[model samples]
Target: MLSRRLISIAGAFSLALTITACGTTTRQQVGIGTGAVLGGVAGSAVTNGSTLGTVGGAAVGGVIGNEVAKKKK
Candidate 1:
């Protein structure tokens, strides 16, 4: 039961990201989106579909992605 819920949450998260990623055209945007998807999936799996976990994971992942995409001067 819990596994099913987690799967659903991950699926929904992935779908949402896919829809949103369609118009992205920058490395930062791609990074953020990819991070969000991976984070959300990992978060959901780790937390058993916890809303906070998924959101927090996405936030953290986005920050990480942004940093990774930063250009060195």
Candidate 2:
């Protein structure tokens, strides 16, 4: 279980990095990547390693991060 969670977290981070490195990432994209990382970590911790919680938290965080970035525009 622990290994699976770690793998998921690693995969999430890798995906975020890949997205960010795809060239010409805007503020919103950066926010999404950053938020996903933070949110996934937070969610996993808060939900006692629940995958659904991690994903939901990442989705929520991504939206919030994007909105916050938009405010600066």
Candidate 3:
């Protein structure tokens, strides 16, 4: 059951990325979006679908993504 749910989430995220691949976006934007999706998915799995967990995960993921995508000078 958990595997199926994760697969579904991955599939949905992939589809969304593919659909928007043609759009112009910064690396940071892409990173944040990817992180948020993955974080939300992970949070949902870890917390058994708890809303707070999902949101918290997304927030954390977004911050991590932003830092990761930062331009190094």
Candidate 4:
């Protein structure tokens, strides 16, 4: 349980770092990455550490984030 929580936290932190580092790039990429990270974390948490759920969440999140970023212009 604790380990899972740690992993989730690490994932979130890693995502934050990734997004921040890429902030200067295209907003679409940043949004997609952010979404993927957030979705992965949520999916992992909800699915009790299922890899499939995490990946699926990331994919969906990435798409949504990408669309949103593109619209922000």
Candidate 5:
């Protein structure tokens, strides 16, 4: 159970990173939008359908994505 939980957490982090990386070529606005949507879904799934987790994840993902996009430009 512990291992599974750890794996899940790691997977979520990796997915967030991958999404942010993919948006790096685009503008910050686009990145933030896409990241928020994707992150929301991922967060919901990871958190077992928690609304707060989804929202929080979306916000964080948006920021990270925007930063990445800005850096790439």
Candidate 6:
């Protein structure tokens, strides 16, 4: 039962990420979307579908991705 729920959550998250990623036109946008998707998946797995963990992971991942894709002088 729990496993099924986790799978469902992960699937939904993935779908949502894919949908959002479609509009990205820049490396940074792509990076953030990719990171958030990966992070959300990892977070869900680690926390067993805890909403806070998933959201926090996405937020953290977005920040990391933004930093990684940032233009440098």
* Candidate maximizing lDDT: 2
Off by over 4 Å in 3: 1-23
**Residue 56 lDDT, candidate 2, scale 0-100:** 81
lDDT per model vs. reference: 0.71, 0.82, 0.72, 0.76, 0.66, 0.71
lDDT assessment of candidate 2: 0.82
The stretch of ten residues in a row with the least summed lDDT in candidate 6 is: 4-13
Off by over 4 Å in 4: 12-16, 19-23
Q: Which tens-of-lDDT digit does each residue in 1-73 have in candidate 1?
A: 5876566566657765775667756777777767777777677667777877777777777778778877778
TM-score of each: 0.69, 0.84, 0.69, 0.70, 0.59, 0.69
User: Residue 47 in candidate 4 has what lDDT?
Assistant: 85
Model 2: weakest 10-residue lDDT segment is 64-73
lDDT at position 63, candidate 4: 85
- Which pairs of residues collide in candidate 2? none
For residues 1-73, write the lDDT of model 5, one tens digit per residue: 4454445455555655675566444566677766776677677677876667767777887887777778642
Candidate 1's error at 65, in angstroms?
A: 0.8
Worst 10 residues of 1 by lDDT: 3-12
Residue range 1-73, candidate 3, lDDT tens digits: 6675566467547744874586898888877877777776777678876667767777787678778988999
3 versus 5: better TM-score goes to: 3
Model 3 worst lDDT run, 10 consecutive residues: 7-16
True-structure Cα RMSD, model 5:
7.0
Position 64, candidate 4: lDDT: 85
29-58 in candidate 2: lDDT tens per residue? 998888888788778778877989888878
Displacement of residue 14 (Cα, Å) in model 6 is 5.3
Which candidate leads the pack in TM-score?
2
